[model samples]
Target chain A: MERERICFTLNNSPVEIHCHPGERLVDVLREQLDLTGTKEGCGQGECGACTVLLDGRAVNSCLVLIGQVAERSVLTIEGLAAGGKLDPLQTAFVTEGAVQCGYCTPGMIISAKALLMEKQNPTEAEIKEAIAGNLCRCTGYIKIIKAVQTAASARLEG
Target chain B: MQDQVVGSSPVKVDAKDKATGATKYPGDLRVPGMLYGKLLYSPSAHAKIIGIGLADAWQVPGVRAVLTANDVPGHNGHGVIIPHQPVMARDLVRSVNDVLVAVAAETMAAAEEALRKVKIELVELPAVFDATAAMAEGAPLVHPEGNILSHHKIRRGDMAEGWARAAAVVENTYRTQMVDHAFLQTEAALAEIDDGGILVLHVATQYPHWDRKELSRALGMPEDMIRVVGGSVGGAFGGREDMSLQVQAALLAMHTGRPVKIVCTREESFHAHSKRHAMVMHYRTGATGEGRLTAVEATIIGDTGAYASWGTNVLRKAAVHATGPYIVPNVKVDAYAVYTNNPFAGAMRGFGAAQPAVAYEGQMDEVARVLGLHPFAVRWQNAMTEGCITATGQVLESGVGLRATMEKAGSLVGWDVSKING
Candidate 1:
């Protein structure tokens, strides 16, 4: 089996790697690239655990093959913060107790970021729609909804 | 008095890593000189292993080793409360998901290809799929010990005398679905024998200590020789408690003398992992004319499936909570755990109480409707307080939040008596 040479920018860093054509982008990033910040909840895209912004749009990294991402820019949970400051959504999640087991937090934060990037003031129903795919069993969704509202308000003020 | 951490909600310790994707799940782990393993599952539900032809699979270029029951070298089984399940089927395959052969290869694709090439000869047997039929006379026993796993009864007071004094009676049956944990992460493990020949398992499990004990016993190895590490779990919801892909991975690793990675696919995850018991419960309750409870009785039957993982405990929990949040003076409960050929049912979130809660709550609603009383009023009147005794004969020594929960839920749902009148 020959390892294919692939080059891509990850979290603002440039990297070149040799991988099989069929290797999942999630695996290449985690195993070869050592960018473990993007999770693979369900190998299938049913759960949004591996959501990463590909060219500024949220996509399931598990479903994307490494060969498909050649020369493309990928942003993951590790790239959410610019410099040393925590992203407002991350701070809001921590303060509002939105994270329970935190298995769904990274994806939730990414999904919320996608929503806030497009709309500064999303309604409650819109917020629910944004995170409907990322399921959290512990918090019963009350606090997560509140966290999204808090982040939306903070974004509005800024 | 200090409040315990159990009641107060705090951020889980693993929350940060999980949130930042920094937590290393078993699937994410990579070991030095590690090999990928894939098991050849029996397609037949019940069968006898005539023979296994491993030549073609071994011929695969990257295949490292092929293991069957002969390779176990140990007890050859693992069971939670009973030793009924074989790690790999010896001569008889009891379930459709039984692993007859295991293969390890350098790449996952090579391992999967090798798995497809492994040949198995099986003779089919009559199997039982339902609990009631399995309990009947002369049903094909799934286990050598027969279909009946465990039966528990809680008889507190005289049911005949209490029912005779009642003004109204309500009898109902309820059913709960077989819900899966569907934890974001599937079952995965990385097993390797260290330089000292010690097999250390890095697994995604809720019970790390228990896995060590069980793995040691099943592998017929010293407990000290095994170190079980709990990796970043996607979520358990009670699914990861049973031995899913652990024992096989460890055995293959130990045999090949290289690290082994066995990660279950989603479909395999659903079939191998334990699911919440699909239960059928019968409830009979008698109350006074004023909607006050007099006595309650219940019969709960649980399908233990293949092994006694946590079915007996689940049955007891269902019986204890059969009366729900109500205050009943006389209670008689009988809970039965029966075996069937269905997928193994064991612990899930809410334990076994969720099944009875729905049933008992429905029964309470029936009682209220019969007495022409408001449902909330009937519930509030009979709700268990802090000093109340549970159906299990255990006193609530601390906080009993049924009434408060009921009131708050009623207020939130707009359960106004005024609305009922109109």
Candidate 2:
């Protein structure tokens, strides 16, 4: 119930907020910093809709409290694009028709970003296993998988 | 043939915003002086409302308004087709998800705490859950009307002659359970009285016109006075076809003179919307030794649950498609939808037509096994042609492509029809 000043690096920018330490990172990002790209599908952490990068590692923002995010680097869907250009994963999703309703797009792209960061050439099964935490009802995950493959191939051929 | 988009996939207009998370869903949007709204649901499945003590809820510091069924400004009920569902349980609670009271507070915590302060008394009643049993004599009435919500039947050709020509008869019973759509995002809505005193609603829904119509009924306002706007929905798949908290949020906003938003948690979302209907189907399909021409009889019972959302239309389609895409000279189908104390069932992927494939198609496989004929051979023999008449007595005059599709599927699956059937 106590409110205090919380500091963290958000989207490559240093930010500070005065809020309860136990508040969820997803809530803090959306309500405090106005980073609404971090979605909250299931608050219980079962769904990866609130996925964000914590020090370059994908984590569900809903599960991490503001206290855990203190002094840590976080990246959200809004930050995935740089210099007004969409990330390759996002572009691949658009071209592959991987989006429907799009609630899971942010988390899917974030997880894919984390995967491609770790391995430039991940196998198809590894790509599926990487995004296994993120659930998508539409697209049946076929388009999403294809989008990831397309993005990886584009990176390889670029 | 001269079209640019017919043979190619085009980028969706909303895809960029959706991927970037720039698209604001109902929950993401906020206005000045907005309050969080929460509703108190029934604990018992069926009960008689004794009293609603709301004084304690109003005593909360930030709680602006605590409303019960009696506080509704206009009509108290809302439903997709029938206006029989009580927005807030007035005299009776029909299901476990029935709303008893609503609270509006500056913060979600305050609203939740205010919800705990409201007191409701109820007398639990007998309940029915099974469709077939609910139709029996002396069953507890879920509604004032009888348990049977709708009955659809199909009868064509002579059963005696068709049965006499059959060499193999397959009879079996199949049942499907209630299935949830489980879209990634739950239900959320925001309602506010705009500058012009018109209520502007932002919601995740499949149909905004229906929302406007139902809101008009619940708020006692003219249709023109309401403006419904669609939000960035996660997924609907028929789940957003009915009202969740559209009326409750509007009423709270109307009373508090501020914007009101209600977001249903995953638990509440499961109970809020109608799911795919659970069906019990019985089919008696007969075919000759050559896997051609006979009679098909089917009886399907669908449990519509607490309210009839789209049960009538669903069961009708079930009966119409009970025989599947095959041609049977004589056909008989009796499909019934019934009311029960369970959660309501409505539109999903198939409405009611998808479940019967287990029965008729199962019968097809059984005939194939009994006659030692290839599965494709049996289906190919009974495939409906252009002039075939459906069980509902509708004749397909043109563009009936069942035979053509079967040929394509057969070749794709390496089914050689020349050596198997002929």
DockQ (Cα-based) for each candidate? 0.53, 0.81
Encode model 1's per-residue lDDT on B290-312: one tens digit a residue.
78888898888888787788999
| DockQ (0 to 1) for model 2 | 0.81
Listed per model in order, the count of residue pairs whose N, CA or C atoms clash below 3 Å is 0, 0
lDDT of 1 at A36: 69
Query: Which CAPRI quality tier does the interface of model 1 achieve?
Result: medium
Name the TM-score of candidate 2: 0.97
- Whose lDDT is greatest here? 2
What does the lDDT read for residue A69 in candidate 1? Answer: 84
Please give each candidate's TM-score.
Answer: 0.92, 0.97
Angstrom error of the Cα, residue B334, model 1: value is 1.4
Highest TM-score, which number? 2
Whole-structure CA lDDT of model 2: 0.89
